[model samples]
Target: MRAEEQVEAVVVDDIAERLRDGSREALEEAYARWASLVHTLAVRSLGNHHDAEDVTQQVFVSAWNSRHTLRPDKGTVPGWLVGITRHKVADVHAKRARLARDAQAVAENTLPDESAPPPDDLLATRLVLHDELERLGEPRGTIVRMAFLEDRTHDEIAERLAMPLGTVKSHVRRGLLHLRTRLEEVDRDPS
Candidate 1:
């Protein structure tokens, strides 16, 4: 192998060891090296940057928390991380699929109670909007929840999340647009 490959092997070995021991520093190093790959994988699979970012964080946290499960004798750290990433991406996609299914049911106006009570149109609309907001995921989902569900102002959300005002606003705006598109679809086909 080349000298660079040797160096990388040594580094991966070190990370593997640190990870096994639950060292926080090694977690940071691992994130620095592999977060981009994880994030990109999530984004490509899920097509949502917010969801991708959440998945990347989830991958690292779950890996580090369960680092004891990783065995160097079995595989390289990068390969292990890739496996974790795949599972996390799948989880995010699964959640989205569930949300889509729920939203579709709401859109179709199906209910178990035919005479118990009338379908709450506003509640159904909220459910659809909330479903899309969750698809935004993580900070965006939390941000939208605070702003709408909690009646928080944009500045308040930024302050609470320690995010810039512009970023909070952007998330809210984009999230609203996503919800709008979903609502329009439902509006066009309310069965």
Candidate 2:
């Protein structure tokens, strides 16, 4: 294996040994060393720092809670931690996406009328959409809003954002792909 993988293997071995020996300090150290890495991976995949941190904490807490079932010979502890982090990240992403879709549906059903104030549900959905857009970050969120939310053409978004047409198109495509993946995740969940 590569040097980094070798180091990871060593760390996993040490952590497994500590757990087997019932050393609390070693378990804490293992969590400390891997938490940042796990969080970073989660944030990259989920596009939300809060969700990433949650997944990271869940991974470590579960590892500790299930320590009795761990078998080092089957796999490295770090590998197992990564697997848990991935599942937890997916779960959180699915939940957030479902909330977003539900909010969107409620928003669509309660349009504002000139004679009356906007419905509370519509206002809530707008807030959730705004928060989700902000969480998406950068040109991707802006591009998605302009192209999809605002009904602007890709060329229009390019002109508005002061970017090349191809760049705007790329951002729209990527943003849509990400959104689709999140939606599919929500659909797949039994909960």
Q: Which regions of candidate 2 fall more than 4 Å away from where they truly are?
A: 1-11, 20-22, 113-191
Error of 1 at 4 (Å): 1.8
TM-scores of all candidate predictions against the true structure:
0.59, 0.52
lDDT tens digits by residue: candidate 2, 1-191? 99998997887788898886778987888787778878888999988887787788888888788787677889877677788888888777665665466446533543445476668656554555565555566667777776766678988878755579998888888777776666556557645
Model 2 — which ten-residue stretch has the worst lDDT?
A: 105-114
lDDT of each: 0.80, 0.73
63-106 in candidate 1: lDDT tens per residue?
A: 98889999988899888988999998877667566545544544
Deviating ranges (above 4 Å) for candidate 1: 110-191
Error at 157, model 2, angstroms: 38
